[model samples]
Target: MDNGKIKHIGVFTSGGDSPGMNAALYGTVKVAEQHGIRVSGILKGYEGMIDGHFIPLESQQLQKTVHRGGTVLKTARSERFMAVDGRQLAFKSLQDNDIDAVVAIGGDGTFKGLIAFSEISKIPFIGIPGTIDNDLAGTDFTLGFDSAINTAIESIDKIKDTAESHNRVFIVEVMGRDSGYIAIHSGLGVGADAILIPESGEDFLQLLKKVKDYRSEDGFIVVVSEGDELGAELVASKIKELNPEVDLRITKLGHVQRGGNPSAFDRMLGIRLGAASVNALMNGERNVMAGILDNQLKFTPFDSVVKQHQLNEELYGLLKTLNT
Candidate 1:
C-alpha cells in the first residue's frame, strides 16, 4: 500500500477505445519506468486480465505513441468480469504476475468494473477518464472529447458546403448515447440553424417552423445528437413533411468521430492525467479517479465519477441565443 511496496503496475484500457488512450498508456509506462517500477499492459481490459494476457511494457515500448489514436493495449467490454468468479481469476492473474497496482483508463463502466473487482481483490486501482461522451463527472473535460468535437465540427463544415451548393436542408447526426456535448459543441461551431439534443425536449413542429423561418439562399443546417428522441432521419422526415418544397439531406457521423490522432490538447490532458494516476497509486491512493477540473489536477471518488451528469444549461442557452 506504499511506494516502496509497489514494484510492478498493470495498465489497461477498457470499454470503447478513444483517441487519447495511447497517450495515456505512454504517460503511465514512462512514469512507472522512471520510478523503476515494471509495467504490464493488460490487453483487452478485464477480459485479458482474467485470461492472463499481460504483456511487458517499458518506457521505450511506448515511444512515439503519444500522438497515436486508439489504445496500444486495445480494449473490450467484459460481462463476465461483472461476476465474482471472473474477478477471482483476474486477481489470480495479477498476483501471479506480481502486479502491485492497476491503472484503468476508460469511462464509467470501466471504473465500476474495477470497483467491483477490488471488492474481491487486494490490488489497488486508479481510473482515468477517457471517453468521447464527456458524460463522466469530476472532470470538466474527458480525454478525447476535444478531439471528437473537432472531428464532428470538421465533418459538419464539409456537409455545410454541400448543403449550400445544393440549396437544401442538411441534418447531421452526432454520437452521444446519453449526453449532448458533441452535438451542442459541433452545432455551435458550424452555426447550425437548429440543434436537437436529448437534454432539450424535442419539439418537431417547432423545429420545422424554425427551419422554415430561417430558410435563406445559403441553405439550412441542423445538428442532432444520436440520443435525441427525433434523430437526424426522423427530424429530416418531419421537416420535409412540413415543407414539401424544401430539399433535405441527412448525414450520420457514426464512429468516424471516434477515430483520428490525438490533438495537442487531448495528448497533454492524457499525459497529465495518466502520470497523476501513477502518482496516486504510488502515494497509496485507491478507488479514486485522477481528473482535471478547471485546468487543475484533482482526484475524485469513483462513485462521483459514475453519477449521472446534468446537461449544461448555460451552454445550451447560448446555442439557442446564437442561432436566434
Candidate 2:
C-alpha cells in the first residue's frame, strides 16, 4: 500500500538465540535491497532497539552467510522491552533513526513485542519466525527447529555412548519451555526408551513404573525435557530406589543446543522466510509475522502468531505409546 518505496527499515532478533538467525538476516537484507530499501540490522534483540544499536546494512554485509549459524546481527531479551516506558523508548530509537518499518526475528515473546510496538508507534513491522522451540502458533515450522532438533539428537547419541559403556541410565535433558516437539522428536529419533515432557506429566510413582519397566541390568537411556515434571537427577534417584544396582547419569544439553552450525534445512528455510517477510512488508502487511500456514507461506498479525499453542496431540500420543 505504501508504493513499495521502503527507504529505511530495521531487523532485530528478540528472545533466545538459535541457529539460522544469520540466514534470516541475510535474506531480509538481500530482498530489501532488491526493492531499493535501506536496511539496518539491530543487535541484542530489543535491548538493541531500546539503545539504538543498529548497523546499517548493505547486500555485501550479508553475502554468503546463508549456511552459517547464529545471528550475525546478535540478540538479547530486553526485559526492558516488556514495559510501557521501555516500549516507548524503543519506538523513540526507531524514530530517531528514521526507520520506516521493522523486521523482528524471534518467537512468541518477540511477537508480543510486535503487538505492543504496533499499538504504540503504528510503524509497520513484520516478524520472521526464528525460534527453535517451534511453539509459535501461526507457523507450521519455525526457522531454527531443524538445527535445534539435530543438536538434541546429537547430544542424545553422544550421551548414549557413555551410558552403554558404564551400564548407566542416562537422562538427557533438552530445552523445550512447554512444547515437547524437540524432546519428542529427539527421543523418537534416537530411540530413547523413556521420554518425558511437560505436556505429559506424571507423578513420581507413575514415572517410576515406566522407568522400571524400561530399565535393565544392561542399563537404559531416558530422555527428559527441562520443563518436564521432575528433574532428571530426581528421576534417576527414584529409579535407583527401584533398582539399587543401576548406575545413573544426567546430561543437561543446556545452551549447547543453541550453538554450532545450522543444518542446511534451517539455513535455506531461514533465507526464504526472511525474504518472504520483507515481501510481506511490501504487500502492506505490517505488524504481522511471515510463516508457513497450512501448506502455503503467508503472513499473520503478530498477536495472532504469538497465541499460546501446543504440540500436535497425535504426535504426543504416538510418542507416549511408543515410549511405553
Report every candidate's CA lDDT. 0.87, 0.82
Q: Mark the 10 consecutive residues where model 2 has the least summed lDDT.
A: 201-210
**Candidate number achieving the greatest lDDT relative to the actual structure:** 1
Superposition TM-score, candidate 1 onto the true structure: 0.96
- Return the clash pairs for model 1, or none: none
lDDT of 1 by residue, 1-324 (tens): 225877999999999888899888888988887788888999999999999999998777687888888889988999889889999999999999999899999998998887788788778889999999999888899999999999999999999999999888888999998898998899888888787888777434447668765557897888889999877777877777777788888889999999999889999999889889888888889988999888889899888888887887898778667545
- List of clashing residue pairs for candidate 2: 44-76, 45-76
Instruction: Please provide TM-scores, in order, for all candidate models, with all chains considered together.
Output: 0.96, 0.94
Tell me the alpha-carbon RMSD of every candidate: 1.8, 2.1
Q: How many pairs in model 1 have backbone atoms within 3 A of each other, for residues 3 or more apart or on separate chains, i.e. clashes?
A: 0
* Candidate 2 per-residue lDDT over residues 1-324, each given as its tens digit: 234457788998878888888888888889888878889888888999899998888767676666677777887778888899999999999999999888888988888878877778978888888888888877888988889999999878888888888778888889888778888899889887778887876434555776664545555777788877787888888788887766777788988888788899888778888899888878777888888877688788777787777779898787767665
